[model samples]
Target: MAEQSTSAESTESRTVLSWSGGKDAAYALFELGTDDVTELLTTISENGRSSMHGVRQKLYEKQAESIGLPIRFVELPQECSNEEYESRMADVMAEYESLGIERVAFADLFLEEIREYRENQLAETNIDGYWPVWNRDTDEQIEAFLDAGFRATVVAVDGSLLDLAFAGRELDSAFLADLPENIDPCGENGEFHTFVWDGPIFDAPVSVETGEVVTREVGDGKFHYCDLW
Candidate 1:
């Protein structure tokens, strides 16, 4: 079995990484040594087996396997509004509290409001939010992560700035430098989302091919996703 965390010698102060089944979560887990982390898991919305982030749940389970981490289940219904989302989060934190969890790690690249929101939410639950890659410039950080042997593919994107051609394409330095100015190279602003295929943090690379590009519309914008498998 993989070793637990070293966050506290007491074995009670367990720290968890919030898995998004994306590059940020993978990157954060990469930063933390397995032994230094009590457990790595994800919180997902499972209404209709669809994730709140619009990904598949089983995909996250597969991802957890790749990282050799176990994921705890947190499911919610679909199309949850802000109030509903907060309620769902509170319930999840309640479970965490029951598990004696005190620290949780997040993989947010660079966002002020999101970070602040996480901090505020965790504060109410007596849990501390740890942002491993907070405030770092997204481009530099993405490049460094890639140079460190991290590999990724464009799993999803905003249709306006990107297209299906980017899906499942290897996220290398060349790809980073060549990204169109319209899209955030780091995808910090939700211009795109990526799934890591290889990294120093992985036991092996995940082989996949682009399937299709689907778009999810929200207001005047749309979230474009490259189906990969």
Candidate 2:
């Protein structure tokens, strides 16, 4: 964890971060500096799990407690359509606008279409979009994350890109060294997703135990998800 300077900046705006309970989101929050961030926002499915990571709501609540930030969960029905998702998110943004929040941050690395979509969504409301770590080299970002003492575990893996064995491993140098050349070091291309347990942004480590790894079939592909509790 990097030591934060007590000096105040005059240009800081109240920002809310899109939290996925994953490494990139944690690292983005760390990069954004928590002083200006007002809350962490996550989308939860009807099954009580995070949207894509499949993390339990209870674990995310624990994460928020350890990170010393309030969190807001946007509930979505199973197999929500894009229009419905947008409408719900617009409502959330309106609520944030009412609270005087000026920006919403995301952890997008180099996904141009994703960023564009986020920006377009925010454009409809008074709040603007913020990207703390954007267009940076994925390899450097991953190295910097580890070098800064951020510890995370791989909790979800795209079975098509990686083996099931990679689902529950820690995100460390050894893991990086073993990754195939096509895989992004930071998993920026969705090769995998991680749960950050300890880092500079956290007041303390989130205590969790890895459970069973299960393979689930989604539309056309299979995903390996490691249960964490």
Candidate 3:
């Protein structure tokens, strides 16, 4: 983890973004601007998939490359406990703090508990947490993402809240319009997750094709994940 830092000091305060390889993370990066964010950090399972969005490590590496930023990956065991997760994250945060990173950024919107958790974690370190897209209206943010010519695909969906068919669909106005009123347009409530491929910030589009949708049962809930390659 210590080897991940190659960051040099700049006049402006530097921040590391907690990237999930999803639309919200991409939009947050856009909102925060590329100049301030020094690096992108993501947690991955032993299987080489992101912990939250299940994006492949290779694919996300491409995203970071296209965005012209260095990325750090924290690999965890398949069945990691919360205690282990926090312990590992704390070490990473401490490392960043030692490297003079003043802040860490998240893409949380309107989730009080989530924000509180992040705040509590950062309270233990010298670094502060930054939320560029916090408390904003999801509808407007989604509209802004589309208006900015960003393109993404729905890579995963909560089967309990959305149909499995939505897993492989492109994220566009039609998809949002078709979503039930109960679901947040930006999927802030974990109703769905997206993989951004093309956008204004990216140097080139990540060429990908949706392969198959596989349902996985975790605890009492089901998640439909679409494979991209």
lDDT per residue (tens digit) for residues 34-153 in model 2: 877888888888888876788898898888888877788888887989998988888878767777888889999999999999988888788889889999899889988999899998
Per-residue lDDT over 138-204 for candidate 1, one digit per residue giving the tens place of the 0 to 100 score: 7778777877877777776666777756655677777776789766677888776777767776676
Model 1, residue 114: distance off in Å is: 0.6
Q: Model 3: which residue pairs collide?
A: none
Cα lDDT of model 3 by residue, 1-229, tens digit = 3224334445354789999988889989998888778989888898888766777989988998899888888888878899888988999987888788899999998999999999998998899988989888889989999999999999999999999999999999899989999999999989999999999879999988899899998668999999999
| Superior by lDDT: candidate 1 or candidate 3 | 3
Clashes in model 1: which pairs?
5-37, 5-38, 6-36, 157-224
Model 3 vs. true fold: TM: 0.95
TM-score of each: 0.84, 0.93, 0.95
Winner by lDDT between candidate 2 and candidate 1: 2
Which 10-residue span in candidate 2 carries the lowest summed lDDT?
A: 1-10
Q: Tell me the spans in candidate 1 whose CA falls farther than 4 Å from its real position.
A: 1-13, 45-54
Root-mean-square deviation of candidate 2: 5.8
